[model samples]
Each structure stands twice: as structure tokens, then as C-alpha cells.
Target: MDQVALLQISSALLLNVGFIWLVGSWFARRWLGSSGVKRNDVEPALRKLDLVAAGVSAVASVVALYAATAVMGGISLQEAGPMFWMMLSTTHYGHIGCLTILAMMILFAIRVRGGTSGASDTASLLTIVAFAITRASMGHAGENGILSVSLAAEVVHFFSIGLWTGAVIVSAYFVLTPQRVATLALAVTDRYLNVMSRGVMLAVILIIGTGLYNAWHRIGTVEQLTRSSYGLTLLVKIALVACAIGLGGYNKFFGLPAAGRSARGVAVVRRVLQIESVLLLGALAAAAILTSQQPPTAI
Candidate 1:
């Protein structure tokens, strides 16, 4: 609950929220539009939300950079100010942080200029992907070198988390409003949920695969999992993720089919999604804490 930890959590949450909004918006427009609702009906609101998320994420990135510089140099914030330019110009972490900020700015610009074209959506998606990649690269993954398996596993793991948990966050809070649910045809709702379920299944698979690799690579032993702060936070994260996955499985197996049958069913699915999103956010907060700790393996 210190400043650095708070900033890390804020930055992680904001970055993922921005990524989710844009990606979810694209999915909704692309698939839901086939059900007779024009994309224009939702595009403006979604775009506005995307822009807001990007703006907050950009600001958080700047603040995080200052904090990281202070920590890296073992200096006070005021003292760190003098070293900030040097770090920004000289370090790999600083370079990735700059790229993350740049990507956020590009996303802001793309949304601000506002067109409903496929090209614009594609550009926005690419920018967000770049932002995710740079953010991942700035983590412990980067310590292993750009081409190492550690970095590759971490990048894949990060994307899987976003696709699974982040998607649910957007769906529960933004995309699946009661009004919007009522407007969407049963078939449309079913199709969207089916597609999402499939995507979530895929994400879960990748998450499990890469998560095991990351856990093994970082913690190294059963003793570490119980003994180290990093491992303990990671245990909490894994528990949260496991609960979220259980909820997701229920939705995929039961919720989607039920949703196809009635409006009430769709509402039930949304409620479950809301709960799942909360669990995922808790896991994300644990991850932020993990990042601030030294791994037992490193010790």
C-alpha cells in the first residue's frame, strides 16, 4: 500500500482497462452488428470510454516512470528528478516505458480523430498491442534478454490474462448494460457469448501453460512458494485466477446455452461476469504486488 505499489497497480489496471475497452468494442461492433444493430449506435460511447481509459493510462505511465526511476536510483523523488532524463535516455526499461507512453498517446489520437472505418479499428488495435508488448518487455522478462523464453512466456501470459479477464471486465461493466442486452436479439447475444466463450477457453489454455512456466521460472521450489513474499503473492494470484476460471467454465458450459433461450438468462450471465471480473481484478492487484517483490529464485 505504499506509493510505488499503488502506482504499479493503478498503471496495470488502467493499461488493461484501456486495452480491454478498445478490443471489446471491436468485438461487439464486428459480431453484434450482424444482429441488426448498427455499429453507430454504440461506437461513439465506446470510443469515448476508450479515450478516457487511454488518457488515464498515459498519466499513470508517466507517474510510474518517475517512481521507477526513484527506486532504481535509490533516491528520493526530488533527487530522482535530476536522474530521470539520464535513465530515460540510457536504460532499456526507460526505453520500453517511453514506447508504452507513446502507444497510449497514439491510441488517444486515433480515438480522438474518430472514424468508424475498419482501418481506424485496425490501427487502434495495433497501437494497443504495442502498448501491451512494451509494458511486458519492461518487466522481469526483459532481464532475461529480448529473445529469451522467459520473455516470450511472460508476453504470452500477459496477453492471455488480458483476453480472458480483461474481456470480462469490459463486458460486465461497459458492453453488457441492461438496456443494451434488451436491445440485442437473443440470437445476437448467444453468438457473442459463444464467441467469447471460445476465446476465453483459448486464453485459459495459454494462461495455464505460460503461467506454470512463469511460476517455475520465478519461484523455483515448493519451499519458496510458502516462504517468499513474491511466492505468497503469486499463490494469492493463482487462487484468484482459479476461482475466476471456475466461474468462466460455468458460464461457458451453462450460461451461454441458457442465455440463448431467454433475456433473463442473459442477465444471469452478466451478473456472473461481474463477479468474475472482480476476482480477476483482485488477481491483478496481487500481480502488481508480486512485481514489487524480489523473487526467491533471484535470491
Candidate 2:
């Protein structure tokens, strides 16, 4: 990949990882105090990753801003600042991306103050919505004549993706992260499994429904799916997404209960989580690739 593509994929990776850190840790707080665990008890674990959420968002602002200028506008990174200003004032995606970057920075500021109120979470959710708008404005969804439905679907899909990524991280942090607190880890993991599972299940449904809507609009037919590069890559992305969903299912239904029963099951759950996180990254990479590919109709 070139610098532009690398930056695009990096932006995706950072966005997902940071989204997971920001929201997963928030939800993890619920499990932190329950199951006979005190809020202060697990504060150390949470504290360690606390800086990550805001730090990454701070980075994302710069990356997303430069990325919009470079990838969409064909401007060099250095010269892109003035061009970015011109585009931001003149173009659609540029406007949304600037707003998204602003939202990101606002969330980052909240995080710096160690804020964790419902208000902060609400702000985070809204910022994520702006980020989704940035996404919708740049992709095939932005090209649609009937743009309202398409943009809405893209937003839904993006939100679901962010939610699922965070859900997976919630599971991964308790079960897979280093620092041995075996009994405590097991307790918290067991406590939050249901919430994580249900959230992920809902996200999967939204992702699928919105994804299908976009795919149908873009590709139009079965033959086009095989004949066109965009559709073919999309199929691969869908398969990878299915793999991620299947892994989550296996962990929730098969692995978590087993983990609760014995140490061996805990190890299995850890491995399952490792695989699942990797699969999610693969799916995201495929999505980044999908954005760059031309649909059959375009050809």
C-alpha cells in the first residue's frame, strides 16, 4: 500500500482500537463493582488503559484530518493544511471530517479530566456518530442520489462496528490482558459475559442489515458480485465478518460457561478472544480495501 492507503488503514485500526478502549472501559465499570468486586479494587487495571482512550482519539484527529486531505483530495501532507482549509470550507466530506475531528478532540479533553459520567458517555456516543458521518460522506454512500437512506445505513453500520469492537475489547481486557488476578478475572468475566454477548448480538444484526442494504444498492445482482472487484472484495469482507460473529458466538455460548467451570476453560476463552480480536482486525482491513475498490456500476 502507498502512504495514503497505509494512513487510511491505520486510521481505521486506530479508530476501532480507541473506540474499544473508550467505551469498553466504560461498560466494564459496571462489572467492576458487581460480583462482590469493589470499584476501587479494579481501579488499577482500568487506570492503566485510561490514557489510551483519549490519547488515541487525539492521534485520530490529526490522522483523520490529514487523511481526508491526502486520500480524498490528492494533496500532499505538508501542503494539505491550506488545501484542507479550502476543502473544509468548500466541500461536503471535508466539513463532516472537521466536525468529526472536533468531536474527537472534545472527547479527548473530557477523558483528560478523568470524566466518566453518563454525560461523557453520551458525548462519546455523539462523537462516534459524527465519526460515522465522516465515514458516510467519503465512501460509496456519499455518491448516492437518494442519499438520505444510504447515509443513514452507513451510519448504522459504522455505529454497529464501533459497538462490536468495544464489546470484544471488554471481553478481551478481563480474560486476556496480562497481570494475573485469576480469581478476580474469572469473577468479572463471568459477571459481564451476558451484557457483552447481548450487545455484540445486537451490533451484529445492525451491521448485517445495513451492510446488505449497501451491498444490494452497489452491486445489484449475484453475477455482479462475482464479476466485479468491489463486490468480490465485499464478499470476502462479509465472510471475515461472519468469522468474527461466529467466534463471538463460540465464546459466549461455548467458552464463557466453560471458563466459569475450570481453569482449562479460562485458557480456552483467552485463546478464543485472541482469535476473535484478530478476526475483527481482518474484517476492518477488508472494509478499508472495499472503500477503494470500484463497483461494477462505476465501471
Candidate 3:
């Protein structure tokens, strides 16, 4: 694919990831919070958020599907369209299974907030496992061990993104809102900040480590980092990741301390989170470009 097309694909993938984060965070908060909202209240908000996420996901998925089809469709049509359908079938099921896990996580939050659940958390986890295996079947995991490692890294990265970002959003909302039914709000926020900070650190490490491994494996040489298409894409992604880390460092050292006392701290945290989100999106866009490029396999 051309650069423009590659960027488009990457942007779409980022959107997919972002939308999933949104669903797992903002949507979950609005629906599952212990804010005296009723079941009636819950359904409406959940439906609205789910609809938006679904729409965005569908668009991204269709574009990705079309692109994948464009490449594989011709070959499959000539050779074995049935096999193509079968692969798509498995992949589609995995997508659904992942989404279902997200939905269950939302419900889990609701139950944790003192609501009840007829669904099982174990089911959600199993679905995630199945989805992971299905995805592995498609990538380098199917062909080599390295792809599975990359996929595992991606899972950690994506889940951490969801947790840290979601916690940031939820804490900010709690702080800004006028409701004061619980004395534990501040305490909860503090504890959450600590947990999220730790999680974000782990995520940063995972992203960097796994990303480097994938790049080294694909590029295969020090010189290729600057000489190849994959290398250039890696450069852009690395820059974005560094910027994100800088913003995170600012939040951790300077901003988080003030986060408790002054409105300025809260504002700083919010702004930093937004910037981090943008950087994450940029990283994803670069990834999209990278996925479509020819790796320096022999070099």
C-alpha cells in the first residue's frame, strides 16, 4: 500500500483501539457508577455509548476488512474462497468475543458498584483467551514464535491503556462533580492514582520492550533503523512514545502532587491525559503504516 493508504489504515486501527478504551472507561463509568442511577438510567446510557462505539468500530473494521479482502480476496477467489470465508469467520468471532469481554467488564464494574449480574466474569476471561488465540492464528504466531510474543505485548499495552486512561477520566469526573455522598471519594481517587501510575509504568515498559523486539526482528540490522521504510515508521512511533513518556513524567512528578489540592493540578492531569491520548493515537497510526510496509526480512 501507498503511504496515504497505510496512514489511513493506521488511523483506523487507532480509532478501533481508542473506541475500545472509551467503551471500557467513560461508557462504563456513566453506566456502572454507584450514583443512584436506576436500571432505566443504566440501559439508556449503555445503549448510547455502545451505539457510538459500535458505529466507530464497524467503520474501522469494515475498512480493515476491505483492505484485508483486497489483498487476500483475489488469491482466495482464485484458489479457495471457502478457506477465505472460514478464516474471516474465525476472525469475526474473535472480534465479537473481545467486544463481549469489554461488555462484561462494564457489567462487572456495575456489580462491583453494588449492582447485580447474571453474567459470569470467567466467561469474559475465557473469551479474551479465545480471542487472543484466534488473533495469534493470523499473525506471526501462526508462522513463528515471535508473533505470539508481540500479540501478548499488545494485549498488555492495550489493557494498560484502558486501565490508566479510564482511571484518569473517572477520577477527574469524581473530583469535579458536586456529589458528595461518599467520604471515600478522595481516598478512592488517591488509591486509584497510585494503582494507575504503577500500571502505566508497566505499560510503558511493555510497549517499549515488545516494540523493540518486533522492530529488531523485522528490520534485522542496526543500519535498517534509518535506511528502511519500517525504520522510518519506527522513528516516528518512537518519537511519539517518547513524547508520551515525557508527558507522563510531567504528570507523575510535577502534576500528580498538585492533583490533590488545587484545581490547577486536576487541570494539568486532564491536559496531560489528553496529550497522552493523542500521542498514543499517533503511535497507533505509525503502527498502521508499519503493518502495511515490507519488513526488511533478509537484510
Candidate 4:
């Protein structure tokens, strides 16, 4: 493949991997919430789900690392053997290693709490760290600056977005439900949702800021934005994000507040959740396209 084609293909794969990770995370959280286990019985279920999610995450990390090595670093697929193998093995093991440690923590927590593991919190923390580091290793934004602090900030920017997106999916799974959950579940979900909302708000702002900075650094002019492949792909990504944001706003302003008020309210929440999921998927698709585009080397 030519450089441009290779760049696009690799990025597309990485974006797909990201989408998979997001879905897996959301699904695991959902399963944990619906396990029908008591607080005392929740540890085992949470541990199992965490392990599953870790496996999914491992695959995603491998795809992301390979895409990074091939596209951003200019290594052909045929020449990517050592780099791909090393990065994949290292990152996968690292994720599994984190899961092992989290499992131990959950066991200890279970012994102390007598039923609950708090495994979900551990999974969240680990995923945030893993994604931030992996993104730093792979993205151009991270390759900027002499100190890699800019890279760290880019990772933070990516992580913040992931947390917001992941949290929304998680909240849709556990909170804003149509079914009758226990009072405790309701309270847990309520607190989580509140926290998630604030986090998402912050994440949106950061994404906008970082995105504008990156675009300015790369595109340099309005004409370049329209004329360049990278710029065009970015435009598509922004459009998708805008649509998703609109759906999110509807969920927040209309669906969430009215949740549980009546049968119609419950129905509305469910519909909006479904719509949000679709929009999120669309955004992911656009992200895949964006990843494949070559970085504008010159205006």
C-alpha cells in the first residue's frame, strides 16, 4: 500500500479496536449490574466481568499498537513484525497484569466487605490508565514536544473523552433503566450518573480545546482544512461528534430528568439510550475514517 492508503487502513483498524473496547467495557458493566447477585455475592461476578473485559481490552491494545507502528511510524506491515509483536505482547500482558492485580484487590475487598468487590471501580481506573498510556504511545499528538508532556496532555484529552463516552454507555446500561431495580441499585446508579455527567462535561471541553489546537498545528489554514485528506476526515469526525452531542443533550435535557416519572418517561429514556448508542457507533465509524487519513506533513 502507498503511504496514504496504509495510513488510512491502519487507522481504521485502530478505530475499530477502540470501538470494540468501548462496547466491551459497556457490556461488562451492564452484565455486572444485572447479575442478580446480592452485594455480598457481587464479588465473583464483578471479578469475572473484569477478566472478560481485560481480554477484550488486550485485543484492542494489540490492534491499536500495530496500527500505530505501521501508520504513524511508517513501518510497512511486512516490516512490522518485531515492533508489532513486542508492542502487542507487552501491552496485552500489561493489561492482564493489571487485571491480576485488580483481582487480588477485589478478593481482599470481598473479604473485608463480605460480598462486594468494588471491582468496577478498579476496572475503570485501570482502563483509564491503560488507554492513556496506549494512546500516548500511538498518537501524533503525543509525539509532539521534547518532554512528552504535550503527549501526556493529549493522552489526558483522549482519556477524558473515553471516560465520558464509556460512562454514558455504562450509565445507560445500569442507570436510566426501565426495569425495577432495588433501592440500593438506584442509589448507586444515581451517584455514578451524577459523577459521570460532570466528568463528561469536562471531557467535552477538553476535547474541543485539544482538537482545535491539533488542527491548527496540522492544517494551518482554512484552505488546507478543505483541501487536505486529513482535514476532510477531521471534518467528518467533527460532524459525527456534533450529531452525537445533540443526542446527548436530548438525553440530558429531556430523557434523564423525566426518568421514572411515568411510563412515557421510562419509554423516552430507553429510546434515547438506544439513539445514543447508535450515534456513538456513528461517531466511532467517523473516528475510524479519521485515523486512516495521513497527518498533514505540510500545509
Judging by lDDT against the true structure, name the best candidate: 1
Stretches off by above 4 angstroms in model 1 are 34-36
What is the model-wide C-alpha lDDT for candidate 3? 0.54
Off by over 4 Å in 3: 1-15, 18-47, 73-133, 145-188
All candidates' TM-scores? 0.94, 0.84, 0.68, 0.67
Give the number of the best model, judged by TM-score: 1
- Among residues 3 or more apart in sequence or in different chains, the pairs in candidate 2 whose N, CA or C atoms overlap within 3 Å are none
Q: What lDDT score is found at residue 297 in candidate 1?
A: 81
Clash count, candidate 2 = 0
- Model 3 per-residue lDDT tens digits across residues 1-299: 55335634754574446344553444334333443334453454444453444445445544454455445444432343345455456765334434533543543444334422334334433433443344334343234543466567655545555544444444444323334213334434444455566656776777677667666667888788888888889899889879888988998888777766655555667677777777866776776676566678643
lDDT per model, in order? 0.81, 0.70, 0.54, 0.55
What is the Å distance of residue 250 in model 3 from its true position?
0.9
Question: How many Å off is the CA of 225 in candidate 4?
Answer: 1.4
Which ten-residue region of model 2 has the weakest summed lDDT? 174-183
What are the C-alpha RMSDs, in order, of all predicted structures? 1.7, 3.0, 6.3, 6.5
| Model 4: residue 130 alpha-carbon error in angstroms | 4.1
RMSD of 4: 6.5
Please identify model 4 stretches exceeding 4 Å from their true place: 1-49, 64-127, 174-177, 180-195, 297-299
Instruction: Evaluate residue 147 in candidate 3 and report its C-alpha lDDT on the 0 to 100 scale.
Output: 48
Q: Over the stretch 12-127, how does candidate 1's per-residue lDDT look in tens digits?
A: 66666666566566565665565556788888888888788888878878877887887798666667888888888899888889998999899899989999888998998788
Candidate 3, position 233, lDDT:
91
Ranking by lDDT: 1, 2, 4, 3
User: What digit string (tens of lDDT, one per residue) describes model 4 on residues 201-269?
Assistant: 777788878777777776778988898878887788788678777877776677656643445554576
